[model samples]
Target: MAKGKVGKTVESLGDYLREQRVASRLSLRQLAELAGVSNPYLSQIERGLRKPSAEVLQQIAKALRISAEQLYIRAGILSPDDGVGGSVELAILGDTGLTERQKQSLLDVYASFLALNAVSDAEFAADGDVAAEPVATDPPADTQDQDPQKITTEG
Candidate 1:
């Protein structure tokens, strides 16, 4: 990405983080306490004076009760169409009733379901005729047509 674009993304991420924090009714000191970061550091993050690491973002997201993926997208670590559906994930993350563990569990289950469906789709595509072919462990290299802009994330 261009330098200008990156700067804009960082600013946008800062704005988004501030909005989430305010929406959760968390003050800077309270959020910093919850996220295990210094009050000044959290304030710097909200002011776009600092670019937080993935780990810090995760902590902040947990404190805000939002998805880290949302933060990742806002930070330009992942694009809009990177892998998951933003809206669905955001909805799950935004649900105040669900605990952090519950949200993570739900996301894991949802991701597993999507992965299984991908495998099934690949198998069906491989077997032109319906003859109950065995599923392959590895998908074809060209499976899903391969997006060059796709961002890969490691657990």
Candidate 2:
């Protein structure tokens, strides 16, 4: 990614974090405490002065009760396409210059799509066809070491 995009992503993530913090009614100090980061660092993030790694963003997401991918999208680390939609959100993120807030709103609303799936995760995993698949096991290797030269055609 270009430096400009990186800068924008950092600023956008910071902005989104600040918005989420406010929306959750969490003070900077409180959010920092929950995210396991320092208050000053959180402030720096909100001010776009520092770029956080995916792990840090995930921690912040956990603190905010949102998916880590959401934070990743805002951070410009992972594209929004990586969201649950599998590629749908990517197109939306691309081909349109939607603001981070708008994108986040769309993602939040889209998250409800889980309710529309034909089968729940447990049900899908329990399908008969899926259950019929063979399970792999580690096989014992031949422990004997034979000399290649000694293996000549011995009648």
Candidate 3:
């Protein structure tokens, strides 16, 4: 594969994953077992010689007991989503283990965290302008009122 910005990002992701694994005190073989991937494959991923797919990143994140969205961001599978934590919100909503109440609680906390960060970001901006950048509160143009299963093609 051509080594470019994406390649560099994947390499950084590998470094990040290795750091997380070391911080969790799990050996490479142990992490590989937990992630249900072969040791050599995981080693190649950690060494930045291979770019893992989103599914692999999810598995590794689950094994690491961390947010899959975090790994997704590191892997460049998804952008920051205007810093609103939209992907994280979706992941939390899609989680089968969390009850409705639990999901609501988590969403509440996540929203509060975002609000706090927005305030801090505003404070650091010139003249503490909260509206420095227009917030993207709307859904993407392509997805607005569209069915998830349906595909639209423009000729």
Candidate 4:
């Protein structure tokens, strides 16, 4: 990432963290204790004077009862698109029972599903229809006698 971008990300992440902490009604020291980090370290993070590691972000997220992926996005560690599988990815990463390889495999599979859905959504959008009905076609021979008012297309 560019230096400027990184700086902006860190600053925004700090601001977001501060906002979450305040919204949770936790003081700086209280949040620091809950996150198991030093008060000064947390203060520095909130001030945008330090870039925290992923582990730290997770801890803070847990303390704030928010999604770690949100922090990851703000920190520029994960793109917004990646957030489609945010909580699932975090669970996979945090699971101690699964080996790293297993976690990676699961993540890959999950990502493939998200990608496939994205493609389908794009195609649907390109069709310029808000509904999911199929293209119009001739009525079946057996249904030709049915009243047109009784016919319906799936949405």
The top-ranked prediction according to lDDT is 4
* lDDT of the candidates, in the order given: 0.79, 0.74, 0.81, 0.84
TM-score of each: 0.52, 0.51, 0.54, 0.56
Candidate 1 clash pair list: none
Tens-digit per-residue lDDT, 1-155, candidate 4 = 55588788888999999999999999999999999999999999988889987678889999999988888779865667764557777777677798757866887787789889999989988888576567888888978899988988879
> What stretches of model 4 exceed 4 Å from their correct place?
1-3, 86-155
Task: Write down the RMSD of candidate 1 (Cα, Å).
Answer: 19.3
lDDT tens per residue, model 2, 56-141: 77689889998776776677644554445445555444425776567656755655564445358668767746655587864445
Alpha carbon deviation, residue 13, candidate 2 (Å): 0.7
**Ranking of all predicted structures according to lDDT, beginning with the best and ending with the worst:** 4, 3, 1, 2
Over the stretch 1-155, how does candidate 3's per-residue lDDT look in tens digits?
67898788888888999999999999999999999999999999988888886567778999999888888677665557646666676676567797757866886787778789989877688565445577669778879888877966879
Could you give me the TM-score of model 3 versus the true structure? Answer: 0.54
Range of the 10 consecutive residues with the lowest summed lDDT in candidate 3: 126-135
lDDT tens per residue, model 1, 57-140:
888999999989879788765457635556566666667798767866776686677679989999889888886658767656
Report the Cα lDDT for residue 33, model 1. Answer: 99
Better candidate number, 2 or 3, judged by TM-score? 3
